[model samples]
Target chain A: MSLIQEVSSFLTHEADLLDQGNFEAWLELYEDDALYWVPSSPEQTDMKGQVSIMLEDVPLLKLRVRRLSHPRAYAVTPKPATIHLIGNINASEEDSLVMVSSKLIMTQVRDNVATSLSGAVTHHLKRSEGGFGIKLKRVDLIEAGGTFSAISVPL
Target chain B: MLTIDEINNIAGVDGMQARAYTDPDIFELEMDQIFRRAWIFIGHDSQVPNSGDFIRTRMGVDEILLVRQPDSSLRVLSNNCTHRGTRLCAVAQGNTKSFVCPYHAWGFALDGVLKAVPDIESYPGSFDIKDKALHLISAARVESYRGFIFASKATAGPNLYDFLGRMTEAIDNLLDRSPDGEIVMEGGHFSVRYHGNWKLHHENANDTVHPGYVHESSVTSARQAEGGVTPQDELVDRGQTKGMMASNGLTAKDWNAIELNGLPQGHSFMGGFYKSGLLAPQQSDAAIETYREALEASHGKEKAAKILGMDRFNNLVWPNLNVNAQFHQIRVVYPVAVNETIIKGYCFRLKGAPDEIFYRAVRFLGTLVSPASMIFSDDLEIFGRVQAGLETGSLDRLDSRRGIKTDQKNGNALQSTTSSELPLRTQSKAWRHWMSPDT
Candidate 1:
């Protein structure tokens, strides 16, 4: 497959895992050192000094996934239905690794409220034995500085 | 419009009227009486330390600009332009030479004086730029207590310190924590909105009984984290995140052991660092050690220990602000409407403290206050459910009579059981006090 096709397919598979509530499988797609970042400010780049909306490593992500499945996690008790639509894919590959950028419009519907979040997503995919492992997944939300309710589900 | 008697009757001894949280008219009255009359926290002096520096904030329901005057004094002015009631400055925060209205070229000085205007021939013969009416509306009183700024529209009630009362210690403790005895609001903030009454946030904050129940999922998830060999870097990550989530899992005995103090003026706080837990106030990491030595150098060892030993969970200043002094964070609540509220969480950077300690503060803030936080999301969920339930009007009033009979007077404030609903009652009583007619 072409670089664009391969990257697009990879993102699709990843989104399918999240969209279908297959969190356990989704965890395997990330490298141990992978970073899942959602900056709180539009111009924010550093997480150490400035707060981020979501800055989770693998361990935190696992904890989050576990909470989502917990019976008492009332925020996700109804189970939000989400469609993570990726478009405008731009991919460049070299040395068995791919650098990909895309636009993500993820819409989550739960308890009759449909909330849509759009962001520019950057992915660093490391070449691995079985497939590519996500080294970094940074999503800069368009409304990074806007007010929000509890975003119980992962984006 | 609710008469003062009707409004006072809303928040009574045993319970509060459901309309207190659901009615738009009552919300407006609250903006007028409680918010406008009381000392409402605006911005920190650290935010705008120099002249021309300013931050946009809200007083009651109206937008206001908290600016530093050319002489370095702070000024709180209504953000609306006097000409057409349009917003004078749309920027969230910035240093400015002057505020020029975007609609018309009417410029105002940093002190809110009408400086200049455009279209000389467009106005009526009575137009006078020098008139005070043409300038931005200013708050009747603006004062700062230890860099924490508060504004009062009424300008006749208690001064900032008097209004802060025992709550001043919460601010003092935060300031004293700094090795250099200074702190600045450095990190960006999280602005979170919930479709719930603003009171629910603070009411839930110091309520020891709700953490174990409202955040059971996160607690259980933390306890059930994979127990196999963890990676080296993930250890610190697991420790802090796990500690924060599990801290809410305190047993009933432990929760009861935690002392809750409700002061006059609706202020309350929780103390008693758990005797055993990851969040134990005594726990010292390398970062903490470094921070301690720095603090010791600035303040002698005894003073440093006293400062560090001041363990507090939530120091709630009535009606709006929640100061977590030990954690170096504060959450400010803004009432958007009857059923809506916005909360902004900010962490302070202690001057002369090791970067590691500040990083932990930043991390602690994210773990606890972020909208995506494991513990906080549940709280927000509960708040939404509360609002939804209250809007149904299934009940006329909400109960708050827990541990009231057990309360004993300590100084001028009422002291009650640690896990009781004393904070709620204290808040409601103050609500009644501020909502009543000024005789």
Candidate 2:
């Protein structure tokens, strides 16, 4: 497969894991040092002073996954059904790292309310063993600054 | 319009009537009597330090601009242009020369004076820019207490300090934590909306019994995570997330030990912060020690300890503000309609403290106030469920008598165990005071 095809496949696989609610498998696709960031502002530069929607390392990620799968986690009791559409895919590979940028529009429906969230998604993949592992995943939602109801699932 | 007896029936000491949360007429009256008459928190002085710097905020449901005047003072002016009544500013916050109406090009100075307008020949001779009526409306009173600003529309009422009652300690403790005695609103703010009455947020904030039942999933999840970082008895944040989640697992008996104080002005807070997570009164880290020394340098060691040792959570000012001093955060509740409310959360950065301290404040806010918070999502759900149930008109008065009998009067305020519901009863008392025919 060409480099673009390989990158696209990896991205699709990762998106599929989250969409299918297979959080355990999704957690495996990330490197131990990987960071997941959903910034509160696209213009945000410093994490130390500025707050973000979600900033988690491996331990925090595992904790979040655990919370998501909790039997009584009422946020997802009647789990939100989601479909993630990815387009405008672009990638560049250098040495041991590949950077991919894409646009994400996720539609979620639960309890008769349907909502769509769009964002600019960026992923840093490390070329390891055979395929790739996620070094970082950042999603900048267009409506990050706007008010929202409870967001139970990852964007 | 509700009768005097009807208003009395809506809110009381034992409980509150369901229509208090569902009646549009009462909501309108609340905007006039409560929000307008009370000293509502506007923002911090740190937000607008320079001339022309301004932040768009709310005073009740009225859109207002909290602007730093050219003379280095501050003014709270209605955001609507006098000509067409269109909103003067659309941006959330920024520095500006003057507010020019987008529709008719009428301009108002930072102090809300009408300075410029286009095509003066098109209007009659009666049009006068110098007339005060042509300028933007200003709040009747604006006052600052230790750098925290509040505005009131009532021409005659208690001053800001008198209205604050015991809640001033919450703001004082937040600023005194810094060695330089200064803090700024630096962290990006989070805004979340819940389909519920505005009062539900505060009623739930200081209520101690809801944590165990409302946030059971997060506590259980944090408990399952295997590590030395246990939230059960830990005083520090280890991975912080688990600590925050597990802290909610505090037994009912443990919660009962914490104290709750309800003041006469409808203000209240739950004490015993040392019992919890990152807010744990004890900081053992090297960075915290450095922060301690800096604070000690500014304030004597005894004063510093007194400052740090004072620990409480959710110091709620009546009507619509939650000041969490130990956590260096504040959540403002804005009423949109009878059933819809918007909550905005902001954190403060202490000037001389270590960056880690501010980062912890940001993290604490995210974990608890984010739209996707594991803990808050459930609360939002419960708030919605409450509004939904109340809409059915099933019950007349919801129970708030849990600790009524046990409440002890402590110098103009009522005190009870955290396991009680004294805050709601106190809130109802203030509600009746403002909503009565005499007021």
Q: What is each predicted model's overall lDDT from 0 to 1?
A: 0.87, 0.87
CA RMSD, predictions in order: 1.7, 2.7
Q: Candidate 2 DockQ score?
A: 0.51
Error of 1 at B125 (Å): 4.6
Regions of candidate 1 where Cα sits further than 4 Å from its true position: B120-125, B227-238
lDDT (tens digit, per residue) of candidate 2 on B153-193: 88988999999988888889999998999999978899999
**C-alpha RMSD of candidate 2:** 2.7
Q: Candidate 1 chain B — worst ten consecutive residues by lDDT sum?
A: B229-238
- Candidate 1 residue pairs in backbone clash: none
lDDT per residue for candidate 1 within B279-376, as digits (tens), equals 83778777888889999999999999999888778999998999999889999999999999999999999999998777778888888888899888
Q: Which ten residues in a row have the lowest lDDT in candidate 1 chain A?
A: A41-50
